[model samples]
Target: MKATLLSGIPLLIMTAIGIALIAQGKSADGRSTLAVGVIIAAVAGSSVIYQIGGWDLRRQSLAHFAIMLVTVLPALLLSGWFPLDSISGYFVVIAAFLAAGLVLWISFYLIFTKVVPRKADSSDAVRMP
Candidate 1:
């Protein structure tokens, strides 16, 4: 669907940028970790607009907040506040990023499903007799 394609563009762009950043060694983690966050956040943010319609600013704002929370989870987890394992180095970093991304995706999906409206179509319109 056109809507689906449109929604996906930002996510794809984010993924490309994340990849570029990782390749340039600007991102904290390598390709996999940064990529997951960028792609997930993009898709999640876009999905809010896709489902709820961009006219509603509140929905869009919530989506942005959701994306932020999702992106931040991994960083929070890896701040050395909690010792989950004896593992260290790249493995720990990657795992933390992936875990955070997954959590964000799940939480956003749940919250958005409740708040975002269903896609509008011709059926929703009333005829002006």
Candidate 2:
């Protein structure tokens, strides 16, 4: 879809810039930039996905958020953000992260729908004989 493609361009560009900054040893700045970029991309871009993916904005947002979380979770865990010596501890940390992600996805999806709104379709036009 055009929306999906358009949404991705900014993400790719900003993420690439963030990665470049990280590579140049600006870790803290780069990390935050990357996060901000992701948030912006996910929040703004989700409207496109929401429209094209039908009215299932929650599902689409969750799917996208899950993909991003999968990419980032291992890094966070390995960096000691969530200690994982015991099995139960692992489950706890994972659950906490999942819960957080769910909250974020839902909040963003709701905000995107509210802020962006749906384009009025011609199909909605009143017709008379």
Candidate 3:
């Protein structure tokens, strides 16, 4: 639930921006922006996979990253945000995508590991004196 809400924030913001763009007469760009936002939100919402029991952190992270990469690559390519005519454009987009993924992964790791408290197991619960 929390993950979904957090993910929706980006979608909401992008929807507003996309609508604005459409109003300004850039319908294609606006629609593409909306599509990208939806894709991002889907990836972000996949964070719930971390909450599933039985999966190790590494497995969960890899699964999530794979989901992000597969979904986002197509979204970006279809959005026309990068040039499609040249090999260099493809390379540049891939590079930027990797850099962004690294930064996001690091930020999420720090936030979840350091900032967010772990779920309190019954054995670790505090008792009244």
Candidate 4:
């Protein structure tokens, strides 16, 4: 509960900042930064919630790595890191967001897995159902 609440703070702050920036004016650079920040906060927040819900660590780690790759890869590609320069800047940003979303989901999975583990019944019951 405490972890969840704490994680929410960063997300809330990012959301508020994004709203404020939008209200003032839709600056492209600002919007991009805001989007990234919001995404990060969401990932962190969701991770906490997953932990509170009880998940295993190994699985969670795999999930986290998957998500991070998904979220950051597109942006990196769009940034001209890749040989293919066909995609426009806007498209790059779009790809980045998609990746970020995937990353956040993975992050949540990881957090829950790491913090919450399965308990052993310590009993051998072989039944064919």
- TM-score for each predicted model, relative to the true structure: 0.34, 0.47, 0.72, 0.41
**Runs in model 1 lying further than 4 Å from the true structure:** 1-87
Give the runs in model 4 whose Cα sits over 4 Å from its true position.
46-57, 66-129
Output the number of the lDDT-best candidate: 3
lDDT of 2 at 28: 67
Better of 1 and 3 by lDDT: 3
Question: For model 3, how does the per-residue alpha-carbon lDDT over 16-127 read when each residue is reduced to its tens digit?
Answer: 9989999999998897988778776877788788888999988998888788777787677767778879999888888888898889889989998999998999999999
Model with the higher TM-score, candidate 3 or 4:
3
TM-score of 1: 0.34
- TM-score sort, best first: 3, 2, 4, 1
What C-alpha lDDT does candidate 1 achieve relative to the native structure?
0.58
Order the candidates by lDDT, highest first.
Answer: 3, 2, 1, 4
lDDT of 2 by residue, 34-77 (tens): 76565556555545555564646557666666655654455445
Write candidate 1's Cα lDDT for 7-93 as tens digits. Answer: 466557766766787788766544455455454555544554535644565666566546555654454454444455755654666
On TM-score, the stronger of 2 and 4 is: 2
The pairs that clash in candidate 1 are none
| Alpha-carbon RMSD to native, per candidate | 9.8, 5.2, 3.4, 9.6
Better of 1 and 2 by TM-score: 2
Can you write out model 4's per-residue Cα lDDT over 1-129, one digit (the tens) per residue?
664565567656766776677787855444555555544654564454335336566666566555545644443443333345455755765675568566865775577558777565547545579
